[model samples]
Target chain A: MYDHKTRILYVEDSLADINLFKEFIDDKVELTVVSDGQSAKSYLHRLKQTKSHFPNLIILDINLPEISGFELLNLIKKEQRLKFIPTVMFSSSDNQRDIKDAFSQAANGYVVKPGDLGDYSRAIETFMNYWVYTCKLPQEQ
Target chain B: MLSKVSTFKTVLENLSDGISIIDKEGKHVWINKAMATITGFTKEELLKSSPPHIYWPEEELDTIMKALGETMEGKFRNFELIFVRKSGVRFPVLVNPSPIENDEGEVQYFVATVKDLTEVRRVQHELDDLAYNYRVLHDNTSELICRHELDGRYKSVSPSSIRITGYRPDELIGRDPYEFIKEDHLEQVRQNLHEQALAGNDLIRTQYEAKRKDGTIIWLDTITKTLLDENQKPTELVTISREITELKSLQTKLEENNRELKRSNMELENFAYIASHDLKEPLRTIDNYVQLFEMRYSHVLDDKARQYFEFIKSSAKHSIQLTEDLLNYSRLNSSEFPYKEVDMNEVLENVCSQLQSRIAKSQAKLVYDKNMPSLVGSHILLSRLFINLIANSIKFKSEEKPLIRIAVKETINAWQFSVSDNGVGIPKKSRKEVFEIFRRLRTTDDEKGSGMGLTICKRIVEKHQGEIWIEANEPKGSTFKFTISKHLKESTNV
Candidate 1:
């Protein structure tokens, strides 16, 4: 019944937040979770080396154990094979400085994590509706 | 003829000054009775003594001999000498010697007259001391003392003028005193000096800018008095000037530094607004998650787990409220908001309407004047101030019904406002502490607040260059009084 589900690479440190996102966005998309920027980088590197299919989108958190979301976005944008993939910043920070920095670094989208569970679920559902179903994303080479 | 000579001798003896005659070889040939008293020797002993053996002190012997030689050459000479007496006492003497020449230019007796000068020398020494003191005072004082003619020309300047103006006394002596005055201050100084001269007896003290030799401007404070002549007419102007350039510049620098410090403080307040705003996001997340947990698992969770979840939810909610209030407090200092003309009556009506349910529940009797004037301030901030005060009155009501009275009086350059509430009054000591951020006098569960309302009100009042303070009301309760200026002196822009 889950035929051709959209794939997403979620880079986050908090297990509770990851579990919450998974429960909210359950069967709508196939999710790959990495706790840190380094692991996310290594996972992307393995995908490229194996000539495996790239994820449909990348969701990056700003604060991480190793490399930050900004550095990861820069790395992704620099790679010839990964530059076309859409990257969205997912963070709890709603600071103007953070928002401006995310946009200036070529992040395709930025979303603040909602405080309530219902709102968080609704925000994810809206993001999926627009990015996954309504809009046409570039096909993986 | 013999009696005539005797009468002449008697007349000479009665003279006050000593009188004697010396020969060309410096021998005492004759002397009167006064000479005998002055020399402390008899007239016979003086006549018998020779030049080297006479009463002349050793230091005066050469001067006496020189005068004797000069007199022998037919030239009259006057010399000062110290003479010793037979009793070893010394006195000052002025001696005049002249040659007596006979017929055919042949020199006869060389006659000399000696006068005691002890009293004359004492009077002359006193005059010399006074002149020396005047000279020292003129040259040694740090103040630039100057004597100027009535036409403003410099008659003389003290030695310190060279240190202050970089010009010697001679260089400035004949120049017009106005030449050294800065061009911008020349007219004012001229007018002041002229007025002081006209006033005659009135001394004038004033400050003016002057130019040094290198063309740098300096400020000088001068006290000027007119020097009057014998007829009491103004003759010269005497000015004592002290340099105050350093003090003037220091005052200007202090003002500049104050402005700079105020700007830096504004920037810091803006930073606080940004920081507190950003802090609210995470707090909201934590609060929501805890609420979600409690709502979804209340039936299945154990009593202790439920209590923990409740504590987490409450703490998160408290933090969110605190951060939000902190943002409001800092925003009061933010210059991003513009000040406009706001009517206080309208603002008060709006506040009453917003708190209508609370007022009705608490049975608050709100009173205010219908005719309130318009003031210059932020409309949002002023309305917020009223809302906070009125809401506080309702929240902190005592056993009796709440009565909140808002009044305004027009003061000079400002409108004075007071909001009096008949409520559980703030304690005398905590009246000041209540205005501090996060400081609440009442910590009971019923009186809930983030404790930033009064702080925000105070900041808003201060931003308008006004003051806000609390005082005890009549009979009971607390009254908050503040002022808002009608006129804004500076641009309230970021």
Candidate 2:
């Protein structure tokens, strides 16, 4: 039996947050990290221009330095080629307004960043277990 | 008989009033002794004079001639004139002249009497001066002063009525006072006036809306009183009204500003909640990476290097806790929590079980009321309050085993609860400081706390319209007392 690794594009501003994500998933999945929304948008635009394969999932932070995560989400959803990719809003805010706005914009999921290290690791693990193993996704072109 | 006649003449001479008789041709025919004495002329000097033409002043000569002509026709009774004395001094006098007719009723001589009026004229002048002063004050004042008959008709109104009601004093007089009252306020005004009339001289103050002559409505604060007659019966109503339109509008504006301030404060609190929540993410990330580093490099790292990692991890964790506490505090302003009746016994049981490990380690004994009263509040927040207080008792334990006793009692309007602990009691001086956010009395490393537990408890209690305080427990312990109102109402913005 052969298994393929899942590819995820994680957009976050803080380096420590990026390190935290890398530590949790280890080598189980192929993770690509960008520090801001502008980099993530440019990278996606380059892949589309080159006809490269899209990632299996996109994790976005709501507060970003340039071109907020909301604006980037709208950009991705507006594009027919990239709209099929599942996007999850991973933010520190459990605010009702933020959650409502995310769901109203067709986000697949919203996860609050847990404060405890063990809880944070467990949350990411559960998310990976379901999205990468249990759930089905459209095959990348 | 001769003696009797002499005595009557003496009486006539001694009279204070002067008496005189004038003929039909306006001549002084007969003058008594009193008349000569009053005019500063001798009796012989008055009889020889021509009469009023010589005795009266030139300004009044025409009036005296008119009186003599009327007297000849038997028309004059009593008339007044200004008489000139022998010294040419003028004084006021009352004159009475009547015709003395012959047998065929033809006019003959005229009998006349004169009386001095100096004292009477002096008092009359004083009364006129007082009336003039009163009129000036009444017209110049800003207040609308009015006198109304028992039937509500305006008897008199001051000139200030024009400035207040846009109606001239003459126009308002004799008009019904209720005519100026706004249509909706007519009935209330009538009722108030009627009640005040029956109150018998007691001044009643009230406010109502009235229409000006220009048809603009204004607020009027009026003080009304009833004037009584000699029989103590209500005869008229006197009212002094002042326009209060500006004051009324200002009051409404102040109320609107207060409501606006409260709404903005709530918005600011919501912003604080979101900001603190966002800040926690970075702190958590720092903590997670530090832990990962320690786990991966503990073997190759020196002791000092490992200790540095521990310090970083600890500081990051503490910062995360502070942010979480701030979020919790601000969340109390949210109106999403619905109030319900919570059973205290169940809440206390759950809190103890949650802290079972700590209690087991410290060997603490927990005592509580068998039948705890249920209170109306948010169950989640109430549970959090008890958990913080109970956990605090376990954390701040003494050398002896911790003895925690929870008691509940019924008060006049609320349920009073006391949680007593046989732990190290708080000092009296720092008792109030402990409730402040991030204020810790015990700074030692062993007794570690976020120092936000009591502040959160205070916010929760205040949200429910209750109060919390601390007291010294007997025999070396501390007691935490709090109250919960029995009635459950909607939460207010605090």
Candidate 3:
């Protein structure tokens, strides 16, 4: 049953947003959460060693503790093995500079958190439909 | 020739020069009428004197005898000497002597002619004094005065060259002035001179950087003029230069400070934008949670609980609007917006349609001319400006259907626009205070506004390099008047 599901790794610092994302996903995918850039980097490093435990998708928050999402994204894009996995920037910031910066750092996509619950739910649902159903990803191994 | 002896004697008597004949024994044998006048003596006294006569100054008697002995030997020449008159006054004279020969060719006596030289000596002394004064002025002045040949070679340089260029006059003369000019300015200087020559400009002023003899750079302010010959043809160029290095450096420092101030101001605007952006996240969370609470527990909630939720939701929404308005206000000062030609009529139409529901609900009518102008400004900003004005007119209506008139007038250097409204007018005392940021006449509970609309409009006008203010209408309303500079270009920035 788990083998057929998509795996997602979320790196975020806000507790409210983390809880919201957990509720929105609702076991539709195999999700793992890390609260800071350092732990997320450690988890990715371990996944690189295991080779078969890599997630199909990664979601990064631009503002984080310890290390910034932009610095972590730069490190991930530079690694040959991790560069294959698609990374998306999910943040409440709708600033054009942040969006442009995300793309310039080789992020696969950018999503702005909506202001209301209904809009946020719809936006996440659409995002899941696109990434899990429509777009294809590299093999886990 | 023998019969004309008397005529020769008559010519000698009338001559301007004094003439005398002396014997070998130093006795005066004959004298002309000029000689008697020149010696200040009668013929009898002059003829009676022998050697050391009164006509010769006593200080030069020995030299006079030596010269007389030389002249008696038939070796005649002109000599300068001082002669004393009988009145004891001494004067300079030029004496020319020749021997008088007999028929047998033996020297018998000497004939001498004397010319007065007092006027020539006096004029020579005046010329020498003038030259001394000119030399004193040229060497002592602080300005670097120089004369250059037509080809730019230094013909003469003042002593001040040492102070201005760190070079002595000897080192600079005969060298091309271009050699001392900085390489970056060489071509420009050459072009300037070439153009002046072609136009026959008598005087031109220019400034440029130059390298001194010690390789230190300095700025020179120079004025050059062509020295013309008698035929009005260009002969040489006279240039006067002064060192302006201190002034140039001060100007450079001022420019640098201006750039630094602009950078810091941009940073402040960016800070405001980012702070407002961060503030929105928490507001969104509060709004979403309140809505989620209502969706889950509405059935069990009473009137009081529902009222509290509504208050929380509305407050969150209001705060969200405030942050968004602040963000847009900051964006107006940034360089992201493009300045281009925009039609005011189109901008007004866009603003009207955006506020169509509000306008209809309030039964407000907008009267505007269709012949609006195209101006250089940001289209989005101008539309926002109009929307805020029209919306305020509708919002503050005074128990009557609102009538807003948008008009434009052409001035010499700008287009003045007026937005008049038949509504509660602003008091004269509060007109200036309304433009201040976050300053509102009405309380927040009475008016549903972020209090940033007028502030944003003021910023937009300022960005266009124009002014905006309020004027009381003739009877019972307020008119908002603003101007747009007709000469604004596409590159203008906030």
Candidate 4:
């Protein structure tokens, strides 16, 4: 199982989610934030140039400004270190067509970002509880 | 007296009809068996009839005598009256009298002949009943038979005209024919009619619009003929016309609705073209970016990661091909592709020459015979149609050798051409399904396909009013058979 203080990379566009996620998850795990795909891609490239910052998990959004979330997912899925990181699709659209498309692209899991704070809290809690506590993850030291 | 009595008896027996003789004093002087039978009386009872009592009133007899007195001077006289038989049967009679005078100039005797009129009267009654029934039938059905002089005056019109046009026959008697036509279209109607008539042609079964008394227009489907006078020169127009405006209006509306539906379909096809084209831009960027990463860091990607990258690269390339096929399919439905006669033999040769390398590498023998009849259709689309079929035949072939044979034959309406290949054949039940998008018969394990080629072929064939179907080639192959008609205009003329 992954450690309680495993460093994680979370790429998100919403500031409120950033604030809420940091407040909820900072005590459970170390969270490194990237505001948009540009920062996320740049950070990833920088890591590739030196020692790889292999995070335990990566949460992705499908809709991004410069590059689409799908393109980033495809890129990460193609990488040796990142392909096994248990990436989850976190998007605002609950469209069934988009969901089917995500699964067809072999995504690990898809999570719809609800506006309700309670639902968001439950969803985030469930995702973390399964991945961090119950299920096993690579804990290479 | 005895001799004269015998002579009178002989005269009465020889007459064809019932006859009686009465003297000047109006007493029945003689009677015959024919007269007794006709009057339904015995001969013994009919002789010695009272003056003017049998056939006429006493007063009418006096008037007859007065008229006959003038005719006695030199004229032949005729008289008619009704007589009752002994059985009370009544019949009309005519009497012709010839006066015979003595030397003293006194009117001594007048010989009168009486003829029964029942037979003639029976015939006349039958004729009158037939004429009455004919008139009633014309009135009920709104059929008017009109006879007009060449000068366009009404010679005769049945009472039926009133019910049809709300105009009495008398009112139409002197009216001009052109006056009945709506004023706006009157000139055109007149020009058409005058030209036909002057060319010695009778306008038969023509349709025109006429204004009623209230200015409401109605269509008249009329049939007319020429009426010739004694000189045999055409002098009149006799026409039969019925109304059909309501039927014509309904047909016009139906056609208009069909036109609107067709326009909407065309707009949808245009949207398909635009969406397919726009989706390509982003796809190109991903492909280019992925290529850059591979070129820059070939050594860094581990075997496991490299395998994942290979899948992604293949997916992008496959997507681009699918997009092109979709674009081509939608482009066909976007605009009206004007067509002309295209020679199939020439088209097949050009396409084969283009795909020569694909044919050589696959060891495929593409055989297309020459002298195929010309088909009337769009060359560009037809060329696309042949290229897709030929490529598929070449692409999917038996491992040893790929052989394709192209042959053509003329059928009832169109020319049938078959492109047979030694490639894998589609199953019988799945033949129709092969024409749908992404409906690959075999799994993509061996060969990849978009499954749009047959669908495109079906669409193009239908547009030309033709058909396409699949049949099995000998051994192990599928033969694609399609037909396009001989030049449509030329076929219609023949």
Candidate 5:
């Protein structure tokens, strides 16, 4: 009865993350991946240019090349066309101030990237389950 | 007393109030004309009316007359009567009866002075309204105004305090004020109040955080003025408390907002400084390129092209200098400087030594009165300030060899210094503009300046809680006077 074919975009640079996300998702959603900030920007731009259906959710990494996640996040949140895309920040460290700032700025969620594969698998599973069923996936514009 | 005196009888009957006469037999032998009019009877009709038979309950006439007899026997008394008129209408009458006697001194008649009770009733009604008004006044005021017992119990409270504390008058009456304070803070509150009382000081007001019955805390700002007992000893504390929890919260929010604004301003200032710092490298590169173009290609280009190259170089350099000065100005407000006593003579010497090249170029006459007073300030900042002012006087030189004179004197709690120059005199209107950062009122031809020297002097003076101002020098020049207060110490708080 649940929407299992949800399009979830993991805007992260780590290859290990792609593997860990696959392990937890187990064909639950059509997982998409982008390696760097420019690629993420290009992927979103392509979706808009071709009038393709956008991803229902996005998980953004804070540390990125070319365009930092802070700037990209600001850009996305400011755009009425893209603001409805659910965003979860995938950070490498647990910074309370960063969490507070993110929350105060209305971030949908925050997830710390785990170090080892076991921790990564568990973290991926938690995030997958949280977004898959815990939140209502957005409809395309 | 004589039976033949009918004129005397007529005089008594014409009185406005009720009047009556009784013969020795205690019979209602005669009633006055006015009395018959008030009783709804003619004098002819009242003459036939008997004493006990004429009045209802019949006992009232007899009992009052009996009391009147005692009054007539030298024990005077006064009383009112609601007597029935002959028409069966009830009315009010005041009777005052005096004894009339025969020539032999035996009792004969009783005469009295009477007044109607209508006005008395009206006055009583007005008194009732006044009492009601006071009752509302006592209930309506929200001043927390209350009388207290000598032992510090709330004797009474206006309804206002009930709304403030969510407590009924009965609940607060016997309770000590300390009970409302939080348990951990109760002793401190008690001790402060006790100390104030023992010192014979009225606790005019105090503020503290109080706990409510629901366990929520509120900041209580109270004013307690003492009252003297009948023996003239301090007895009670009349407290007026306004629940300042909301006000205190608002104050906290306002303070936080102020801090936020201050931080944002600092960040913006730092941004400006960083931008200026980054621009300097490019500006230097631009200046170097312009000079290279002039040196390598001046023979190939027209005079106009060479002149254009010079203007470009100059404008770029000026902008770069303005940014640097602006960075310094903002940094002054953003950074705190430590204080030390600085020797003005040393400062002037250093400034003069730095401007040696500029002084030599002008072949300028520089006069330094080395016996200047010592000032308390930031040594490095003060030296820079002096250097800037002295250089400006040289830079703005008119046609003649510039004459610059520096002098110092001690004033109340401060030292004032004047650096007068016989250079280009600044106009009065343009003086204010000169003290604004990077503002130049005159053409850049006569002098090339960052236009921030005077502003930097202003900043330095302000940092020391001192002042710097411009004045017209005699004949044709400008004078820069600056004062440094001796109390130029660093603030204890950041």
Candidate 6:
């Protein structure tokens, strides 16, 4: 039932929110969580240099120190090597304008952070089932 | 003598003026060919007649006899009188009478030259009428009609100058037009006048600030045209001007109000955005952490403790919902979405799919017409409207399965839509207040709503230049009806 767990990069600032996500993502994927946008950029740069350890999915939080989720999405879409990896915006905002902006900046999906723990677990399960287990990705070379 | 007489006859026949000779006894002795033609009579008929001849109209007999008596006394005078032709047509003639003397120095015959004045009088009457009409127009019109010299002096001014510029026509005439213009606009006005003179008949129009005679400034919109002479050279400039001070001030005031309104609207949108993001973030965190704490320590937490956690989590969640609903309501104050051709059926389908879980949980039966018309609107807003209405029905359902129906009616200028549900109907007292923000009729803890659904719906409908209201559905239900204008314009800054 387990070959290689699908690799994912989660960009967030709040430790509690990341822990909350970690509780739901348990044993489902090789998850790498970064605290801020600066660390996320450096991690992506290392993956590009090594030609390995490239995640299959990247989830970004909108409000972060130094840079925003939309800016990182823009940078990722512009890079030839990092462009193919699927990206999603996970935020506490349910603003329609923000959702529209995320999609316009080439984010694959926008998911709002649910307040209830049960609802958040269900949302994470559905996101993992569809983006990780179902969708196919380009071979990392 | 006979040869001299014949020579004189030839000269008189060629004269354009009618020549006639009358004797002292007021009888026609002889007349020239022109006289016969002018009177429209044969020479034989005129010569054979006496004082009261066939040419005399009976109405002028007294005047004619008085003039004839004066001519007989050698008091010669040129008098204009009416003469009748043989065909009974009367015309005006100028008679020049002179007494001819014999060798005994006595007056002999009255020789008169009659000149027809019909064409002259006709032209004089036409000129008189034209002058009268021109004077009436120049005096009565409200526009300041002025004729200016090539150098910008007023050659002539209409009587309306007194009303428009507080100056009489005599006061304005021969005055330089720049004298009335404000100093700041004087250069521009002079430049415009120069350009207009060079542009010929292109009809240059300009608006400028000018001082009235009472030392008050007014706005003048003047159209200047170059009046050309026969050789196409511009002889004078004619300007037709009217005061536009009131219109200018109104436009300025309206612009200022619009600017103020725009500033306040932007501030409101900024406030809503800040509240939605900053305020809701902490509330969401509180709810999530509270739930996580309960899940981790369920054994240690007794029933009372667990109920306390429930209250905290619920309050936080309600706060988050309230913030979200308030943001949505404020966002509708400004049109952030552009209108496009949206299919109503598709919008409803999307809305139903969004509320699939809620519908399944409540076992609600949803029905609607398949042939909904396409219209111009914001698709996202319209979908939210339907979703809110349907969710509201499910939230307030009675002791039976909920039944909701969406219907549309085509109006002359709009598409009227109604969403009806067999739910616990709102009482008559609360029906009108339901559309107000935060006006919740039910305070039940289980019903998780922000009470802004109908308010947002009403705002959305109004943004499309439409209206919304609530009506009691027959046999126990509530129906929310609204209209969307057929020709909705895109992006009005409501």
Winning model by lDDT: 6
lDDT-wise, the better of 1 and 5 is 1
Q: What is the C-alpha lDDT of each candidate?
A: 0.82, 0.82, 0.85, 0.72, 0.73, 0.87
Query: Candidate 2 lDDT, tens digit per residue, B256-328?
Result: 9989998898888878887887787767767777777777888998899888877887788788878888888
Q: Chain B, TM-score, each prediction?
A: 0.59, 0.56, 0.60, 0.59, 0.60, 0.54
Q: What TM-score, to 2 decimals, does candidate 6 have?
A: 0.60
> lDDT tens digits, residues B114-144, model 1?
7888788899999999989988888888789
DockQ for candidate 4, C-alpha atoms: 0.01
Best by DockQ: 6
Stretches of candidate 2 above 4 Å error?
A38-54, A70-86, A100-108, A136-141, B1-275, B296-313, B336-376, B407-413, B443-446, B486-494
Query: For all the candidates, what are their Cα RMSDs to the real structure?
Result: 15.8, 14.1, 13.7, 18.4, 24.0, 11.4
The predicted structure with the larger TM-score, 3 or 5, is 3
Q: Which pairs clash in the backbone of model 4? A: none
Worst 10 residues of 3 chain B by lDDT: B194-203
Measured against the true two-chain complex, the DockQ scores of the candidates, in the order shown, are 0.27, 0.36, 0.49, 0.01, 0.01, 0.50
Off by over 4 Å in 6: A1-8, A27-31, A43-57, A70-87, A94-110, A126-136, B1-164, B169-211, B214-216, B220-247, B333-336, B352-371, B393-412, B419-433, B471-479, B490-494
Candidate 4 residue-wise lDDT, B221-268, digit = tens: 776777666876777777777777886687688889889878887777
lDDT of 6 at B246: 95
Q: Order of candidates by lDDT, top first? A: 6, 3, 2, 1, 5, 4
Clash pairs detected, candidate 6: none
Point out the higher-scoring one by DockQ: 2 or 5: 2
* Ten residues in sequence with the least summed lDDT for candidate 2 chain B: B485-494
What are the fnat scores of the candidates, in the order listed? Answer: 0.58, 0.63, 0.74, 0.00, 0.00, 0.74
Better of 2 and 6 by DockQ: 6
lDDT of 6 by residue, B16-49 (tens): 8888788777778878898888888899988998
Q: How big an interface RMSD has model 2?
A: 2.0
How accurately is candidate 1 docked according to DockQ?
0.27
lDDT tens per residue, model 2, A84-105: 7888888888877788888888
lDDT of 2 at A104: 84
